[model samples]
Target: MTAGTGLIPVHKTDNINKLKSLFPALVHYGNSDMLPMHMPGHKRRADFMGGIGKYDITEIDGFDDLHHPGGILKEAMAAAADLYESDVTYFLVNGSTCGILAAIAAVTKPREKILIVRNCHKAVINAVTLRELDPVYVYPKKCGSLGVTGSVDPEEIRQALAKEKDIRAVVMTSPTYEGVASDIAAIAVLAHNRGIPLIVDAAHGAHFRFGADFPAAALDCGADLVVESLHKTLPSLTQTALLHVKSTLVDDGEVAHQLQIFQSSSPSYLLLASITQCLALMAQDGAKMMATYSENLCSLRQALDRLATVTLLRQETGFFDYDPGKIVFGVEGYGGRDIAALLQSDFHVETEMAAPRYLLAMTSVCDTKETLLRFQTALSRLCHGLPPRKAVSFPNMETVAAEKVMTPAAVRERTWAKRDFRESSHCVAAENLYLYPPGTPLVVAGERISPEIITAIQAYVEMGFMVHGVNDRQLFVVSENMSG
Candidate 1:
């Protein structure tokens, strides 16, 4: 008999005996005659929303509690730790956001300095604000043509550590949304030498362990604390994430304690079961799955490489490495938005993100050759149809590096007013403004807004890209009287 009873079909016969996760237990409990008097009001009613309600359960007897796990849940996390080779692992149902918040809070005291990459996700900024930590910025090398931030240089981390004596932790994102990975091993060494814990937001790198073609996982790269979004690159339910502790420099107990404060009390069993099923499948058949996936990706890349105008981003000079799964393509004459629109309207294909210079097509292990072929076909047609290459006006991305005037924590609580972006030059921004797909803030709160920022925002908006934190051409700026 086969184990999987969910949406994903498991065909590998070898996985029959190897499957070890909480998912089968959930199915058994769901099938049992046991009546429910638990917190979930659904009460195992399969008719509520298909058969999903049957598996959606609360922390019942053998299922174990997520917060104070001692039984099945604990073992499940341990299996994940063993798979990822981490000393300790915790399942995060609240997504990587909660993990980032907890990891930052656990490591440093209030107002303690931490070095953070400028191109880090918004969650990193939120963690700094929540923990009231002082953040010193380290910027990533830029891919000049694409206008996208690439790898964080190890030299930058070394220089920052030498300069900031009080820095307790170093935080960065590897395998950026566009799949640009940094040299995590070298960065980890620099931080460990200073006795500072290295925390990596590897949200897009959950699948790195499965394939040799992918860049190295941060857990294997000597990071003290690493957070991965299983749902991002792996076959798991949305919001499923994992936090791993690798070194003695980090207190695993404190991370567990912080998770208690940040993670949800009533964790969704359906999501946990999804995580279990994902882990089990990967444990059993991951090598085969990745092999097939890599083959398909390679074929698509070969086809894409033949296109004259559209350029596929593979290996570049600045980043340590690149993930082949992220299919980023762009032409000099046409904006990413232009190509994205054509893909949607003409080909009925949707991409992950449309940047000013490139459109991102995110692929996972689930992407079949047929689907990839369809995308390749669409892109090739679009490439042939696009007008001859000519320069198009794009944002001057260098202006995004705004100067910080106040701490994020201080500015977050201050009174604020919405002002026009055009006249808000030199004003302290009260809210995070960023492009949604890649949520690196253009201007975090406390940063003095530059005219170039205003210009960039307008250009992004004009190019048919969504710029968050703008309310009908207005931006939230700290009120004059609230200035410290």
Candidate 2:
């Protein structure tokens, strides 16, 4: 028997599909009579990798390489570009992390200034550190009682661009972890006026293009480079993402080169197949699915609105626009951790994330009406059962931009000491410290740790939030001798 011939066959569909290329090619190779001699030592065997081994291929003949896509992979990427209306799109098996890194590196040279939205994902910070780019900050506006950051004002971008004449590129995250989106069209215009290319880390907003109910995709909003995680809001395997290049300002060759640097050489064909399948499904039936999903979310919101203590956060004044899929619920007098724990322990429903004042539940087109109703019922039960207790006001973290003492690269060369987070006041941090779910650094490396930052960390810790980069409640700061 050929390698994995004994495995149960995947079901076949006769109907013609849209954006169909890579998946079919992989499957064809898997079921062929060819002998087993490939780099993937599994050799299409379903022994250890389960059924996935059958399609888990390497850069074999006809499969086409991810880095140098000239065959089926090229066609698949082209189809995705068409679907997304980008000039060119590349599949990212390494997820949005590599995409963000590649995009930032492609557009800016080392030590060049790149204006960054301060509340960006930690990957952006990593990109700045890796490329050694000098980052100028533009913090997002605060909205609502949840203390979640809102959109970056276009005016702020305009001001930063006008002030920082040496800035090479601009980077921002749209539809933050809490689902608030910036005015990308306006911001893109502001960046372009200064001849700077805008790179939007739209990892959480991948589904925006699939439905009218969602915010506009950053690519369509005129961003030069847009990186999206297909897995975040779509039905794709984890670590699958897409990087789109739409403007002449960004060099496609440079982007490809940087992606080769950041992404693994042996990209997983299984993940590629997952991306192909997801895109095909989206191209075919995504609009209908998104419509139904939007309707269900609305109904769920209406049900949630009836709760006396529980409040569902929606688009309010000062917020540009919010993604409907992010379900943020807040109950007075209760920490978000408590709500999330009750949902997990009592109702068996795990939420996406929890902050000081609010718990976030992420919904996608994959969620069914039954699932939404169950979540709604769980919230209703929890909200009714809990009594009103003393509430702690959430600090306005949006206003607390840490003092930048040095570049992240410079901080890496210094001696570090671990100090109790509370006692670490006024010390320059040697590492990033931020909440885990959002991963936005409250105090990035090379920044002075102020008392306000310490208080914020203590508050989050007291409310049971996971603080990353802290060991045993100790934060890494520049050693006392190096403090000068």
Candidate 3:
């Protein structure tokens, strides 16, 4: 597998010409105006600029509606569903967050019990609030050395479901924020045996379906519902995603209704069209492209593994399989935030996520060999003169307990309200409160804030990380008007 040969095959002149033809359709599709813009104020103005003005289109006659996609948009979604081998697929213009919300709402009824992994995205928490559903929280396996969340153990899920016999569904995140994948197949079987549906937040695993050597996708592992963020790892525009329904546990009508409840009425035709184009590209040549990408990732990892002061995380460290495209490296002596700043300021390289100990860099099929090599070169230079890092103490696992304050449905009725941080210490939270990069909430609404949570919040603030759901930059409290 040479650099520009097998995996990264050079596109023939004809292939390039075919790709060029797509531009005109995208441009012409933008000009099919039906009426004056009542939604997005842009109105196709030149001042809006770039792809925004050209693609920021609304629902019109010729353009099939989003909610009731019976025409071109539906056809596009069907094509994507076929590619993924799913029973049905819906185009999500509001990112995977909306898909997650819809999936939770579709699977569980109000006040029904659900088993959810604690490391799930805030969107899942929001679903719990909206449905007023009771959740039995399952903690992810902990990596003491890295202070990072690992995959959820199958046994834990089994125990939680057993304890809560009425659990309507189980939701988990495969290939977590740090790119750690779980035994999704085993968990799916467990859920199915208990007559419960399994919903997987595979937002970071969209590319898993493409590569043969990659970890199994949620849908392939028997999950009933899988939500993927196409833009995260694929060459699609941001906020373009797919929601796949695979089992009879969830009806198509219920899922569709939930989608309508959560999704925007006037969806972006540009985003919908991009989903089609991305799926087409993936169906045609995804395997070949991903093979090349995997080869590059292996090469890049090997190069980074040899660095003295930096430790590149791999599956062998009791942490299971990882997404090769996600390059997570720990700077031995320096803080991750400081290293990220240095890379951005001095080396002109920006990373995806930065924590106290490690930084993440996401690679895609679009990444060039030169680009990766450049990142490696910058890293080597940065590590040359770094000082010894202080040993930072992270909170113990026992301190972070799941406290159920209200059902999912009840939490939803309380609109997200903002208050002063100083006044919010004891208030019930209405929104997710956590750091942006990792997006983990320390205190969800309905749960009282413990000293440990306050400590975590203070640590984040001291590290220059922004803490959401706080009032006046001092303390964070939950919203006052919370549902029962």
Best by TM-score: 1
Instruction: Go through the candidates in order and give each one's C-alpha lDDT.
Output: 0.85, 0.85, 0.76
Overall local distance difference test of candidate 2 = 0.85
Residue 415 lDDT in model 1? 94
- Candidates ranked by TM-score, best first? 1, 2, 3
Which regions of candidate 1 are displaced past 4 Å? 1-19
lDDT of 2 by residue, 254-287 (tens): 9999999999999998899899899888877787
Instruction: Give the alpha carbon lDDT tens digit for every residue of 255-325 in model 1.
Output: 98999999989999988988888988887878679878988999999999899887788868786788889
RMSD of each: 5.1, 7.1, 5.1
What TM-score do all the candidates reach, one by one? 0.94, 0.93, 0.87
**Which tens-of-lDDT digit does each residue in 1-484 have in candidate 3?**
1122112223323322233112345477667664545556787665666546665666655567878877666666666666777889998989999999999999887888889898888899888877878878888756734666877889988898888889899999987877788888899999999998999999998888878656778898899999999999898889988899999788978999999988888777667777777876876788888887888888898989888777776664545566767787778767788889999998999999887778888888878788989998999888886776655554353337746665545555666555555445555555567777667666666666655666666676677778876544654334565443
Residue 197 lDDT, candidate 2, scale 0-100: 97
Comparing 2 with 3 on TM-score, the higher-scoring candidate is 2
Summed backbone clashes in each candidate are 0, 0, 23
